[model samples]
Each structure stands twice: as structure tokens, then as C-alpha cells.
Target: MKRIGQAMKRMTVLLLAAALTLDPLAAASRQEKALAETKAQLLSHIAVLASDDFEGREPGTDGESKTLRYIGKQFFDLGLVSGTNDPGHPWFAPVTVLGREPATSRATFSRKGKRVFVLQQDVLVYTSGKRALVENAPLVFVGTGKTIPSRADLAGRVALLLEAGIDGSDRQTALIQAGAAGVLTVLDGDHTLENVAGHRQRLGYALGGEELGGDLDAFIAGKALDAALAGTKLSVKALQDRAAAPDFAPLAVDLAVSLEATTRETKIHTHNFIAKLPGKRPAQGAVLLMAHWDHFGTCAQPPAEHLICNGAIDNASGVAVMIEVARRLAKSPQLDRDVYFVATTAEELGLLGAKAFAENPPIPLSRFVAAFNIDSVAIGPAGQAFSIVGQGLTPLDADIAAVAKQQKKKLLMDNRAEAFVRRQDGWELLQHDVPAVMVTSSWGDVTRVEAFLENDYHRPSDVVSPRLELGAAAEDVDFLTALVRWFADPRRVPYRSAAKPG
Candidate 1:
């Protein structure tokens, strides 16, 4: 009997050792398979979306139709619930886009009834709608124009402001609220008025009719500014230096500005693709994933090399990651809270889809745990750090750091946070008090983004090439998956707030 018991114990020990050795191997194999599958899907989706036939995947065009249908079908196939509130299993949220093209754009600035600025050279003007006209409005140099000064009242006056950091603050909103008639911002960066001339020609659109106010938002160069302040007590350079100081005063410059612009109006329709995976626990709140799928449409002026702006990196990469992540999560065990994936539209236009979604969400705003935006990603290799674009805007940095550590990668704040954080669709949700963050590879390695923008940011050359690698994008998918998993965990519900980092 003792010999029999010893033999059984030996057999049990051997079996336990075998299980331990094989379990890790099996897990490694499964992980590799999942990564391989996701990578393959990412490449395939980019190929299809970036094809020239899609006409650049522009909003409110044939490209939009094809793109939305493909995304909806993929989400449906992945078994995710429809993101819409409609009774049927519809995945689209129709958004109306009112596009206005500049017909006759003009901005003329004068000092004491003498013209000192040249249109498209010294100054450029843009309107919110079809036409904007402000004649002989007194221009008051309001420094940063961020807050209403105690002694200064800019009622019915044009506020001349030095360009401020783009930290998601709406300067125009503040200026308008301060009773300013219009705003004329001086170009402060390395860019000149000529550099921004091309932007005034792009199609401008708004989400709702009321959102497009009849305000003049114009850009002026240093040359015109110098001419305006030529004989004034405060020189342009001196005033700019003083404005940078902490104790700055609002100055009323000795100049008045005039603007007249007209745009041809066009009405179009766009769609936001949404899919949700309901969780077991409802109180944990839902996790939102966002990626803009729209790009520059069929170029009115097609380039010679490639007629279409195949935005392989601008967003096809992001949508592919979102789809792959959704597929994997759909098959995984039930999460503690719901996960929502939104493929926003008109992001190229002006974050119209995101604005619409924020304005009318499928669920209550308070139920959203956190919002994550994935834009133009992976232009580099894996193992590199990931940047949180709106790092200080929310407390999600802790969550991002934790995920990065688990992936054996690094976490850093976006170096150009002020410039990019509010530029993406995430900004719309952030404005509505949703804790949103944009994760990208461009945060730390500014060169990667600069290279992309210089070569193919919004041009026809943006087509997928050997230079555009997917290693970093693949890693980001894993990082985002981990974040969602954490957010969905009932025991790990995140604290939602809009506290800026000190």
C-alpha cells in the first residue's frame, strides 16, 4: 500500500510540472497568434481604405459612403452592438455638414484711413459662414485676450490678439463673451501670412447652423503689424515682450480694421460609425474609443503622381486598430463595463461628427468612464514610448503609465500638447466635460510627425509606402486594449475630472 501511494504521488508531481511548463508556452502562442491576426487585419484594412478608388475617404462624398459601409460591416461582423439609439441594429449616426467655400476673400487693414496690409501677403481673412463683413471696426490690441481686464471694455471693437498656445481653450468664445465684435490674430510662430494663404481656400463647415456665427476670424503677418504700430508709443516687438510678462496690461492700439469675405455654400451629409459591447456591470461606466475615418476628399486639383490623397496614416491606420481591438474584445470574456467605439466623421472638416455625438450621446454623459482618441499613428517602429496628447487635461496619465509599463513600453506627455491636444476630435468631447485623451507616437519623437507633415501629411503622397511602418501602431493597439480593459474593470473605475496639471 505504501509503494502504491508513492507511485501515485510521483505521477501527480510529474503531471503538475508538465502543466506548468506547457501553460506559459500555450499562452505565448495565443498571444502571438492574436498579434499576428491584428497586424494582418491592420495592413489589409489600410490597403482597402487607402486605395485611390476610395477618393481619399473624404466626408460627405462617395468615399464617405464606402468608408462608413466598410466600418459598419466590420463592426457588425465583430458582433458588437449597434452604437446608435435606434431600435434596429444600425451602426451609423447621420451628421449634417454645412460646407462653405470662400468665393471672394479679402482682408484690408488701415492705420488712420491709410492701407498698410496686403491681402494674402500681410493679412488673410476667413468667415464663419457664406459671408462676413466688418467695415471700419476699431481694433484694440488686447494682449492675449484670454481674460476680461478690469479697466478694458472691448464692446463692439475688434480684439487684436497675439497668437496664444492651443491648450483647448476657446479664445474666440472668451472674446465674444467679452463683447468683442471680431478677432484678428497676429501670426506669431515661424509661419508668415503667405504660409496660411492656402488654408483660407479650404472648405469650411459647421455642425449646426447656429454654431457658425457671423464673426470675422482673420490672420495677419508681422509686416502688417509693424506698419500698424509704426508710429505708436508701443512697438510690436515691445508689446509682444510685455504681453509675455506675468503682469501685462491690455493696450488699445492706434488702428482700425476692415474685413469683407464671401463664400459659396454647399450642403452635405456625413456619418459617424459607432459600435458598443455591453458589459456585465453597469455602474462601472462605459469606455469610449474614438478615431476619425474621414480625410481630404477627391482633390479639386489632383496631383500628378497620385490623384487621390490616400490618407494611409492620417487615419486609416487608426480605424484599423480600433476594428481589430473591437474584434478581440468581442471574443474575450465579458467586461465589467460597456466599451464604445466611435469612428468619427468630418474630423478633417472640423470635428463635426464628434461635436454632434457629444451634443446628443446615446447614453448619458455621466455614464462615460473616459474617452480615448487614436489619430495618425505608427509612423515608426514598436518599443517606442507613447504620448498622452492632452496629458494634464485629465487624470488618465496614471492609467496610461500603468498600461505602458505592462507592455514594456514607456509613457510620456506630448511635447506639442498645446498644438495637437485640441486639434483632434477628442477636443469636442473634452469641451463637454468628458475626460478625453489623444494617444499617439508623435508626442516624444517630434521628428516622426514633422517628417510625415513635411512629406505627406495631407497631400497625395500620403499613400502607404515602405517608409511607413506598422510596428508602433501595433504596439499602440495593445496599449489601447489594455486601457479599455482596465477602464471596464469594475474594481478599477477611473476618476473623471477636468483638472489641468499644475
Candidate 2:
């Protein structure tokens, strides 16, 4: 009896050891080789959608209608639900934004203790957020501000931050977070004084500030002005020396923030085309995927040399990849939760599509498990597999990494850099507290952003190019498939407890 027991124990130990040892082959299978017919179906769809015949798929036009219907038909044919289905099915989300040209804004800031009026060159507009109005009133001087999630000092006043000082406060973020009347920031960020442009045009969109009025048409310029000093004192040189000091703190002034801005009255409608993949035991949560389908709408060129602004690669490729992923997933296997595939419109117009989608979605916003966005994967082989932007989100990275291993593709995150979490559509999701990630290769890279813009972006030549590579696209589709499968699986949910250091 003792000898028999000993033999069984040794056998059990041996089996466990072998199992651990056998775990090395990052298992990879060309499973698509089996789904060839499906691949053909998808490729044919992409070809037509990307061809010049589609006129670049711009929104609010005939081309947009044709493109939407075609992709919608593809979704229907694939058996996945439309994201707009009132219930757990197909759907369309209508989004809108205020589109208007800004009038020249002429305003003056009188620095406290200074008799000379400051240059308007110090301000810029931070126009990327919920649109609202800036009424005529005296802007209050709120010291270093406070925020919602974190308590910033700027509770209710317009932050009057000194040009180059770090007042132990993040002025811009704080003012916006605290909901100040409006932010009138100068070039106080960590920029070199020597590089400062002498002339400031209103507030450039790049800098984080806003025009006193939201979108009023007015004439303006930043001509030097004289101010009547009341309190202590300061001359232009003194003000310059103070504003230029890195630690300078903005002194409060009895300044009136009198500017006028009102809503456009008629709202601009943006859209988010949504699709769904129903899962088995869909845990109250869902797997979300977002892709922006809007590109620069039309080209402003002479008729003889003009053609539609074809956004074939800027977004047709992304839309194609997402559509294929939805199709492939519909047939392969089922998951525990629903999968939402969204193709947001007007992304080219300041991420209006993504912004609108996040504001109000068809599915219960809170039930979302995580978000995966496939932006631009024009090429790959950069690392082992393609590159993933915004892999910084803990839970998102874990799933992408695991799936990368399964596909025998490197879960390469360290080798690349993409402010992607904050750059494209992914950032919109991140703000809503959803764990989101964007998977892309070179096309997804930062250097590639301007590169694409320089060549095909918003240009007529953006149609499917002979030099374009579609093979890498297939790989992207495959990666997305694997990622969705990993997340939707009941027990294999994709949220990490901690973020791995790069």
C-alpha cells in the first residue's frame, strides 16, 4: 500500500512540472487562413469604400451617406447588432457641435502694480471642451486654482497667474477644472523666454486659454496701451521683469472681464455610428471599441485642380480595420458581455464624434468594460507586433499584452512613444474614467501624424495609394480580434490592478 501511494505522488509531481515547462511557445495560428471567404468579403468592402468612387467619405454629403450605408450593410451581413439598437442591438447616435469662425478679439489685461498695459501676445485659447458662453462681466482674480477630482485653489475666480511663475499651482488645468469664468493665460508654461513670439494673435488654439467671447465676429489687435495706475506702482520694464520671472505670481487687479459670446442658436450635429457583438453571460459590463470615421470634410481648391478631399488612409483604413474586426468576431466565438463598435463622425473637427459619443452613448455608459480604438496602422514590424498607443492604462495593457503573447506578437510597449492617451480619440474615453487603449503601428506614431497630414491628410490624393500596404492592416485586424476575444471572455476580463512601469 505504501509503495503504491509513493508512485502516485511522484507521477503527480512529474505531470505538474511538465505542464509548466510546456508553456513556452507564444502560441500563434494563422486562423484567418480558415476564414478566407470572410477575408475576401471584407477586402472587397474595403476596396470599394477606399476607392475614389466614394469621394473620400466626408460627413454631411452624398459620399458620407454611401459610405455609411455600405458599412452598415456590412455590419448587418456579418450578423452583429447595430450600435444604435435601443435595446442590445444596432444603432446610430446623433451628435452636434457649434461650428463658427472666431472674430478678432481685442482685450487688455492690466497687471496689478503696473501702469503699462501687458502685451496680449501672452494669451491663447483652450477651446477643446464642452462649448458654452462667455458673457460680459468683470473677470475676477482667482489665485492659484483648485479642481474637482483634486481640490485646486482656484474655486471660483478667473485665475490671474503671472506670466512665467510657478505659483505652486497648475494655473491652466486648475482654472479649467475649477470652472473659472474664462482663462486668460500668458506664456507662463515651461517655455523659453527667448522663443516667445513678440506678437500674440488673440489666443492661438495651441495655448490653453479662451477668447472672452465664445465665437463672436469682431475686429481686433494687440497694440500697446497705457493704463491708469491706482494702487502701488510698476512701469513696463518692471512688469516685464515680473512677468518674465519664472516664480512670478499674478497680482489681483480690479479688472472687468467684459466680452460677449453666445451659442450659435442652431447646433452642429455630429454622429457616432455604433455596432454591437452580443456575448454569452455578458457581465453587467461591456467591451467598447471606438474608431473615428470623419476626415476633413471637403477640399478648398480651385475647380480645375480640385477633387474631393479623400480621407482613404486618414480614416478609411481605420474604419476598414474596425469593420473587419466586428465581422471576424461575430463568427468566431462568443463572449460573456456585449461588444460595442463605434465609428464616430466629425473626429476631424476637434474630436467632435468621440466627444459626442462619450457625452451620451447608446449603451449604458457605466456598463462599459474598457475601450479599444484602432486609429492608424499604416505599417508595422516596428517591434515584434504592431504598436499600441495609450497602453498606459493598467487594465487595458494587461489584456493587450496577454493577447500579444497568444498571437506570438510582442506586447511591445516600451520601445514606442505616443502621447496617444492624450492625442486622438482614445483621450476622450480616458477622461470618462474608462480604461481605453489605441493599437496602431507607424501610422499611429507621432512622427507619422504630421507625415500623413503633409501628404494624404485632407488632400485629394488621399485615395487608396498603390504604395499603401494592406497586409499590415490585416495584422491589425487580427490583433483587435484577439484583444476583443480576450476581454469578452467571462473569466478573462481585461483590467489590470496596477500599471507596469515602461
lDDT of 1 by residue, 1-502 (tens): 9999999999999999788668988777776777666667788999988888788998878888899888888988878889787765378887888878767757666778887655455666666666778887888777877666532467767888887532213885578667777778877777666555665676667875645657667777766677767777766688689787888777777787788777788887778888899889756578899999999865546346567888999899989888878877888899988899999998887788899899878877767878899888858775567788888887677877876777677777545645777788889999987889977553457678778879888888877777777877877787788888987875766434213311
TM-score of 2: 0.68
How much lDDT does each candidate structure score?
0.77, 0.58
Backbone atom clashes (below 3 Å) for every candidate:
0, 34
The most accurate candidate by lDDT is: 1
- Give the winner by TM-score: 1
The count of residue-pair clashes in candidate 2 stands at: 34
In candidate 2 the C-alpha lDDT for residue 124 amounts to 32
